[model samples]
Target: MGDRQDAETFNNLLAAFGMARGKLQLPCVPALKARYVQKVIALANLLEKPLTSAQVEELETAIAQELAKGFQASQHSQLLISFQPNPKSVEQLDFKITCQIASLAEFYEAALKDNFATDSDQLDRLETSVFGKHANARVLDLLPELGDPETTTILDIGAGSGRNALPLARSGYAVDAIELADTFCQQLQQQAKTENLPLSIIQGNILDPLLRPKLNHYALAILSELLVHFRDADQARLALAKACDAVSKSGLVLFNIFLCRPDYQPTIADRQVAQVAQSFFLTPAELESVMDGLPLELVDRHSVFDYERDRLPSSAWPPSPWFINWATGRLLFDLEPPPISLQWLLCRRI
Candidate 1:
């Protein structure tokens, strides 16, 4: 059959199947319903041999029963159901899925780049896009609490694009950022120069001994989205200890890491399967244990829900449904609040 005929035939089958399965909730229009039933019957007749009315009814009943049973079986599994009232938008759904696949493809491509943009404008945009305004405000909010001194010196570890560094510098804090990516270091320097912000960028591993001596020079330090990259617990702990030592006794060492929960069976994303393998998720308790012997004290801890608004300023999209289920439903962490998945912590060196 032609494509048009095939589409009509499919719609008819869908309507009839929906009705028999008690899934159809459209308007009670006799004409529309009749047309739908006719299409379904036509398809059924094509699939099987010519059937009497009784045979058609019997087949419909059998199909409905099977569908209900399938749904019931699915309920026992950890499957999430999203209701879409209109099923006529298969093209739209296909387009959306295709776009997502394309975007992921691009992300992998960009991940392969030897250098990424970390310019001031780029950094600001990245921060605002990824974390939103509230997170930016939170960073600023925590800054003053670090206390004013002769000069505000900050060590931003994992300083991806200097998101926190630029803001801190704009606020008059002298910022020094350590990033492994040379491209990011160049971008950061350009951004600092453009804004005339006294920010310094060092291209070297934080684990390097050559960089070790310079660690104790900062008054404050931050490790936003950094700890998750470390594979060894002892290394992370040692890094935190070094951060504590870098800052003055009264200075603050602020950072955030991805906390793992019991239900967190490692996934492709967790393993960086899509991109270069780098990040490791850790349990909050495991992190606390890592910091046990360190001089840093956990002054505050909370969870940040990532919510994003569309460009049109419509409704907000909560963290991906999969993330919500993984973080909250799986009970991965001993989330102090009892249910949150992502943990944000602030610490001060004693």
Candidate 2:
């Protein structure tokens, strides 16, 4: 079948690529298999029309395994690649990669361009407007309030599009922005280069072991609009612990949590829908419980909607009382309430 042929073809191509390097015993030239690798990838792409999603995943896995093998073999043959594997360390053991959203850059970019274009103001700004005013601007406001920008360093976990980081950098603050999306990282790098911003963009999971040594160096750490994406409280807690660990004592750590409406309760169907969406909302009390022992102290909490209402048009006034009463079901005896918008929590590393 095509799946079997896909695997065999990949292995054969890898072998040929390795052999093309003249037995792989001499000095390894850079990109020795670049041409053949491209060929293999093209063949895999060609199969896309016939392969199911599962089949495509299986094919990619086989290709990755074989590619890894080719690289490993080149070492034994004394033909080194252009790079070396990183040294493993204990910090890696502390943080386990529970989830890795694949093709995150592409997915996020598409979502931002399509789904959020009308619904989100964050995506509307100059493309580099990675951070919107409601949630992100509030987080950014603390930078000037903290002290001198020259003396400060900020670590922005999930620094999508450098929205917050770029502004901070322009203000003469040092920023270390970590993002998982490759496309976003590239965009950030391009923007930094174009604007000559003092932003260091790191493209990797924030919880990577290689980043542990650099964790505690920041004076300000921001996790803007990110926690809601986690599957549950425990996973969010681990991420928070890692963020706290990366900051010095008394360093400012800021993040936002999407709070469920006070009266909201989900039915079985509602929970199923949320699971499909991969979004989990937590109450303020639930968020506090998760941060119980972390080396952080709750400093400021703001309802971003209320805090930034001035930005809206006169026509965009607060929700009508009728709608609110209806949503809360004050007219009825009992029913679950709908979700409120966003809530932010600002904490300091204790």
Which RMSD values do the candidates have, in order? 14.4, 16.7
Measured by TM-score, the strongest candidate is 2
Residue pairs with backbone atoms closer than 3 Å in model 1 (clashes) = 260-282, 261-332, 262-332
Q: Write down the TM-score of every candidate.
A: 0.53, 0.57
**Candidate 2 global TM-score:** 0.57
Candidate 2 off by > 4 Å: 1-103, 112-135, 207-213, 275-278, 311-337
Backbone clashes per model, in order? Answer: 3, 2
lDDT for each residue of candidate 2 in 38-98, tens digit (9 for 90 to 100): 4433443443322335544544454444444543333112222221112342111111111
Q: Tens digits of per-residue lDDT for model 1 on 50-109?
A: 345764565445444433343233211111111222355321110000001212123323
lDDT scores in order: 0.53, 0.56
